[model samples]
Target: MEKQELFKIGDVAKMFHISVGSLRHYEKFGLLKPEYTDQETGYRYYSTRQFECLNTIRYLRVLDMPLDQIAEFLRNRDVKKIQEMLQQQKKRVVMKQNELQIIEKKIENRLQQLQDTLSSELDTVRIIQTGPRRITWIRNKLRPKSYLDLETSIRQLEKQQENTVVFPGKVGIGITKERLLKKQYETYDIVFLVLDQEDNYNGIVEELPNETSVAIRFCGSHADAPVYYAKLANFILAHKLTITGFSKEITMIDYGITNDITKFVTEIQIPVAAI
Candidate 1:
């Protein structure tokens, strides 16, 4: 058959090393469309020229672009518009690269620290058995401009709780999935209360489950968490274990709680596969 002749879905699927189901899925998602359809046979056919278009859809989807937006862009197919979209994507990728670099650096530093700690006779690793505890905490939405406000708000909460004599656990922070995907820095909650306590501290109290593993106490600011994460990730990989959840940042020293980044000492906890 000549190159201009249309190929059936199965034919194109085989040629592209993709499953027929996948092709249908792309179509269903509005990411790809067959150039022609035989009403009688109910078969889908695509020209060879459509291969490039299909591949473009696949490539964009790999980058996590929404199919609706992809379809809109394809409909217009304006060179300038496509370039603008690509530039935006490029910015996102660059930001991700920067974050990865930061993570890599932290991991390197943590590895060295681990080696030093292990080798030093005076420095001993402790495996602490911690039970579930109830914590009273407040979750606040944090913006980049008001990042400093998070500490201030948390400190105020602590003071208010202390005055009211409410349940108190280690102050902890949580990151939402949305922030992670957008590369936006966010602090979802600053919770306080022990994990297995019966008393609810007048504030919002959350009961956290017990973590069974060695908890390393790192004395450092928020910036130190990244390094700790890197160390923890390395440790998990080295020991052939998987990190089961998002790591936790637990404040070990509050000194009556302050937002000063320099004085914050927190714990970065990661649940792992048992050795």
Candidate 2:
């Protein structure tokens, strides 16, 4: 019988479409090994016999199975055991696929929000009817002094609500009627996450019902919120629309959407009189 060809590390990596370091990583984790190694030079080599094992390792990795799991599967080499491992990996893959779908839907929603905000007339107030929405939120009466503190609190809220909000969650905040009336633009009392109606989540869920609202979608960072709030207040007064609820500030296009402060859209909505 003819001897099968032996491949060097670089050649094996190319054949596997993986980096050399990855092969080294696999070997370090004991998930795979070269068929032969030179004792004196310490050079590794792979042969046809190792090819099937290497391919199996690669397949398991693509399914996101941990190295330890793969190593255990390889060491056992039992049909039932390997089948059980593969079944668990299949469940993980399906979960990831479902997560990706959720993420895609979130992207679509953000894009639609951006399109709608950009198309609307800047600084113009409009009275529009909005349907009911449920939100899971964290409220802080005293706003933080620094961005770091604010971010830390936000992170804590997310951690607390990790299982409460679905993947790719949308965050928003609310300013009180007193604040808008007093021009306390930077002071936000409540921070909330917008929840889909069908989302079965646990947390402080608040239902905002349908109402005619005086809303102004403005483009800029939160620093510009005060000015837009004033604009919205003026529009409400001019149209004889009485403020009916705590002003809701929806971050239509927030820091999550873009890095440009000018592109961030803050929609100030205040439920108004039906007339």
Candidate 3:
């Protein structure tokens, strides 16, 4: 009989940079067994042919295949079974890819918004040309009067939807001309998230048309928005602009940048037409 080449467990572990414990685990799970064992010292050795089995195990593990499934597949080594498993994993990878892309877009927008807010002059109204946008929103007949109202309003929006957005920003508030004229600065009739035109939404969504608008970026809480709003109103009057749509109070720095509310950046935009 010819002597077959064999590898000690230590040699196999060092060669693969894998733990000997993992090889032992594979044995316990009936996935692979050592080709030879010395009874006197209870030492294990693997045949050179078993290296292919270990390679297959490592490959399946990297693909996140469950151990039990890997064991079953290895038992049969069926081409059709491997194809089906790979197909299922591919679907999961595709879903994760889409989710990552959405996250990347949000991060990019947040960075741009933070930079714009840092560079902007507070209390100065500016005219800008805006493209079309859409929003998924919560409308409240009674305006929000406190932070509790903001929380409650957001809860209402989430209550009706399959998924809720708590960290999404920039936050939007919509107020009618009547509300502003009545000095209802403490209350906002609607809160919204600006949505991508292609976003999947089944709830109340409003499409804002492309138009010229006046906007003011300022620092403070919602209670202090009237000051910036007044500045916008004055700018509109001085520039011969007419109010054309609801006012939107968007949180440029949606996350708190500092402990003080005065450090928070909020931007207010009102659609307008030249008189």
- Per-residue alpha-carbon lDDT of model 3 for 122-171, expressed as tens digits? 87778989898877677675454334457766676556555434443445
Q: What lDDT does the true structure give each of the candidates?
A: 0.57, 0.73, 0.76
lDDT of 1 at 66: 68
The runs of at least 3 residues in candidate 2 whose Cα sits more than 4 Å from the true structure, single-residue gaps closed, are 1-5, 142-156, 163-171, 177-188, 196-202, 221-223, 226-231, 237-240, 251-264
Q: Give the lDDT ranking, best first.
A: 3, 2, 1
Question: Model 2: how far is 71 from its true place, Å?
Answer: 1.5
TM-score of each: 0.39, 0.77, 0.77
* Candidate 1 residue-wise lDDT, 1-275, digit = tens: 34359998999999887899989988887777788888888888988778998888777878867677788888888889888888888888899897677567655654664454335332122334446755555555543222244456556555644333321124456444344333333344333333323222455655666754434456554544544554555555566765443335555443444455444445555555565
Q: Candidate 3: where is the Cα deviation over 4 Å?
A: 1-13, 19-50, 64-68, 141-149, 160-168, 254-262
Cα lDDT tens digits, model 2, 113-207, are 66777787877788889898887667677443322334644664567444545332255567877666676777888766677644556556788
- As for candidate 3, its clashing pairs are none
Whichever of 1 and 3 has more lDDT, that candidate is: 3
